[model samples]
Structure formats: C-alpha cells, structure tokens
Target: MRLLQQPWPLKLIWLVLLGEACAALLNREWIVGAVALTTFGLTLLPLYVGRVSGVHIPSGFLVAIAVFLMATLFLGEIRNFYERFWWWDIVLHIGSAVAFGLAGVVLMLILVRGERLTAAPITVAFFAFCFAVTVGVFWEIIEFTADQTLGTNTQRSGLMDTMWDLIVDCLGALVGAAAGWIYLQGEQGWVLTGTLREFVRRNGRLFSPR
Candidate 1:
C-alpha cells in the first residue's frame, strides 16, 4: 500500500534495464552500458521527468548515445588496429575524426540554438570533449589488456596507435567544441534574424503571399 504512493519504483527499474540494453547495443560496451543505465535511471529520469513532468524519454541523451556509437564503430584503430601504415588506415582515422567532430558540432547546434535547451552549452561541450579524451585513453588500455590476456593476433603497436588516436581525438574535439561555442556565443544564442530578414526581402518571389 505504501508503494502505491511511489509507483515510479516499478517504471524506474524498467527504464534502467532499457538504458543498459541501449548502451550495450550502441557502443558494444558493457561498462558504458552500466553507466548509461544508472545515469538514465537514477539521475536523468527523475530530474527531467519532474522538471518537465510527463515526458517519456530523454530525447537529447538518446541523441548523444547515437552519436557516440556511430563514431566509435567506424572511427580509427583499423586494419592491424595497432599498426600505422598505408593510406587507407590514415584515411579511415581522418574520416572517423571528421565524422565525430561534425556530430558534436551538429548536436550542440541543435540543442542550444534550435531546441533552446541545454545544460550550459559551453560547459557541456567541454565536458563532452573531456569524455572523448578519456575514451581515447581507455581505448589504448583495452587494447593493451587484450594483447596481454587475450593474445595479440589482431593487435600491433600500442604506442604509435595510441598516440595517433589521442592526437586525432583531441583535434576532433577541439574543432567541434570550438564550432559549437562560436555558434552559441551570446544570449540570443545564434539568432539569424537579420540574415533571415535580408533573405526574405531579396527573395520576395517565394514568400510574397504564401
């Protein structure tokens, strides 16, 4: 009978499990899954739900997960995984870095400018970059562990690959974070009112009456 007052207990558990499954599916990572589950369930859910009350999903968090997953899956540490050689490997890393950078920039723009919702856009972007850096570190650690424990059939030079990956990761994050900061510089937050007005005035053919 006492539990009836907090029916959220049941629903919360379900959300936790759901988030864990999503994290695993997205990153193919178990630890990330565990973190995702706890954060979404314990922190993200109740706070946002109470703040917005009646919303089902934390849509923005979902978007972040999606971006992270896509970047992780396709970017860098390819072919011998630890070896640095040839053009295609470099190309793959560059592509991954660009994709990740663009993803961060686009997400921040949408969150800060288009949606007008954020947890301090600059701070969020910074922390996101930091997280990306940490991820780069973890990638090397995982590789080393795999080499030692699971054998090095797919592994190669940890030092070179790790260093290059770190560099690429930082560069990507810096570029992306800078773009987001520029896009959201002031209080009005990336408004294009003047630009839009000028466009409409010149293109009277399109919006003349329709």
Candidate 2:
C-alpha cells in the first residue's frame, strides 16, 4: 500500500528522542519535582503546539531546539558561581548545532533537493549564528532568573560556566549551518518525497495517524 511509504524516521526520531533526553537530564536533580514537571512541559511542547496548529514541525528542528534548551538548562544546574568549568559536564553531547547546521541544509534536504548553495554565504550563516546566540542568551536569562528567585544553584552553576556554554553553543550553531549548507550543495539531496507533502497529497492516509 502507498501508506507504507511515509516518512518521520531519522529526522523526527532524532528530534523527539533528543528533546526527551535533554528534558530528562535537566530534571535529574529536581528536589520538589517541580523542575521535572517544567521539563516535561517543555519536552511535550511540540505535541501541544502540533495539536493546536494541526501541523507538524520538522522533528529534527524540534529536537535541535529541545537539545539546545536542555543544554542551557543543564549548564545552569551547576553548584558555584566562580569555579572553573569542567570538561566532562555533558555525558552525551551531540554537538548538534554546528553538527546539524540549524537544521538548515539537512532539514531542507529532508524536504527538497538540487538547491545550490547561495552566493551571499553570510545570509544563512548570520541567521544560523543569530539563532544560536539568541538561544544562548535566552538560556543565560533563564539561569539567572532561576538562581535569583528559586535559588536553583544547580541551574546557575556560575558566570564562567554560563559564558563558556554560550560560546560553545554559538560556535556549534554557526559551524553546523555552514556544514549543512556545504553538504546540501554536494551529492546527497534534501528529503522531499515520502514526507509530509506526500502525506497531504495522498489525503492523510500515510502513517495511520497514531
């Protein structure tokens, strides 16, 4: 049957699972369990939005953001504020941003193909960096607030760690975007067929609407 030919394997799987993982990790030390509740809310955000919007975001993108948010949150959960950050902090660091390129090239590939890299390289690159930097700042803000009000020492380990985390994340985003763009222009094409498009075109009979 044509229904068996739908998508959502690699991309969606990575997104959902990664997001869930980050959420779980951040909540690892929740005392009153409120943080866990908050993380659960975050991890399921896409599902909530998807339910309301009647549309699905690229799983990979969701995963990327989730993981990023989780990274920021995890960084926040340090003990002191002036200690030299350690190296083995992240047990499962995927280096996702710089690796996946803002979900740009690979994401686009998951949708379309044959698109050449643009001449204004800075265009995509800038946005990609902006996304990371912005998210980094946002994470910092969340940490500060958590520390100021809730006294989540674990969340705001300190200034040094927070700063370092932002820098690392920004680098990952910028670099990843470039890599994705480069790969796009190479041989492997973006994924389009057997995706949501085909799902809609075929009258929503693709994946059994789990």
Candidate 3:
C-alpha cells in the first residue's frame, strides 16, 4: 500500500512486472510467469524493511532495481538474451555484483551508525565484497536448481559458465569495495560517493551515532 503511494519510478516497477506476467501467461510459460510475479512481489520487501528501519529509500534505487529485474528476468530468461547476445549474461552478472556490493556497504554503514556494530573501513569493505560474492553464489545455486529441476539451460556451459560468472562477480564486487574504501578516505566518485551522500542526507538518523 505504502509502496504504491510512492512516486512514478516505484509504480513503474509494478507496471513492468505486470507486463512481464502478461507476456509469460500469453506464451504459456508457467515457470517464467511464476518467477516474474514472485520476484516482483519480493522486491517490495526491501522498501518495507527500509521504512521500518527509518530509512528513506531513494526512487533512483527502486528504479535501478526495476531495470535490473527487467533485464535479468524479462529479457535474459524470457526473451533468451543470454543465448541471443553472448555478453548479455556476463554484463548483468557484473552489474549485479557491483550493485549488491554497494548495498552491502550501505547496510554495514547503517548498522554501524545505529550502534549495532563497529568496524574498520577495510573490514567494512571486505564484508561488502564477501556479501556480493555470497549472493552471486546463491544465484548460481538457483541457476543450477532451475536447470536440474525445470530443465532450463540457465547454467549455460554448466561448470565453466558458473565459474566465469563467479569470477566476474568477484571482480565487480572488488571494484565496488575499492570505491567504498576510497569514499571512506574522504575521496569522491561521482556515482558512488554522490549516491552515498544523498542516502545519508535522506536518512541521517540511520547514519548518525546515538
């Protein structure tokens, strides 16, 4: 309810989900339809968690996620972009890893600021990297499961594909972690530090010591 009341970017995510659902249903792709709907529903959980925690999630963040879902689920899986464009999956995997890594850093900062934990800058960055890699592993597990159970070729080249994906994920995560470390050192990158500043400004309570 609250999510729907937000601005157009948030609403756009739902609209994309609905379109994906309709496309899947029309094509008789039950698995795709179910995953699309389920993922869309699951995306709301983050906003709910943020609101409960007194964090004002930015519209750009929601829109970024929406674009990711559109590319990954709708285009990659349903439209077979993975097969059509050889680099599509690779690009998405790298982007997802970086995004997750940045999110992990934000989460760590929130926790530390909330008096829940303390850590050195390097430690926090390392945690973010690990968090991204861990998510990547879980995603690969999902791909494996889907390939085995639903007879999908999400794994592509099987072991080789999984290995490469993990490697790329790790590399992307490292980049994010490095950027975060630099930011912590009072340096600025337009996207990373700018976004962090905006996030902190919007939810100062979460980024302030009690």
- Candidate order by lDDT, decreasing, is 3, 2, 1
The 10-residue segment of model 1 with minimum total lDDT is 73-82
In model 2, the number of clashes is 15
Best by lDDT: 3
Off by over 4 Å in 3: 1-45, 114-119
Q: So what's the TM-score on candidate 2?
A: 0.48
- Top-down TM-score ranking: 3, 2, 1
Q: How close to the true structure is residue 100 of candidate 1, measured as C-alpha lDDT? A: 50
* Model 3 CA lDDT for position 192: 71
The RMSD (Cα, Å) of candidate 3 is 3.3
The digit string of per-residue lDDT tens for model 2 on 69-183 reads: 4544433343211234455343212264454345443333323332454334355555555655666677678878888899666443587767677767766776656654444
lDDT (CA) for every model shown? 0.47, 0.48, 0.81
RMSD of each: 13.9, 9.5, 3.3
Per-residue lDDT for 99-172 in model 3, tens only?
88888888888778847566577977998999999999999999899999999888879899999999999998
Where does candidate 1 clash, by residue pair?
none
Spell out the clash pairs found in candidate 3.
none
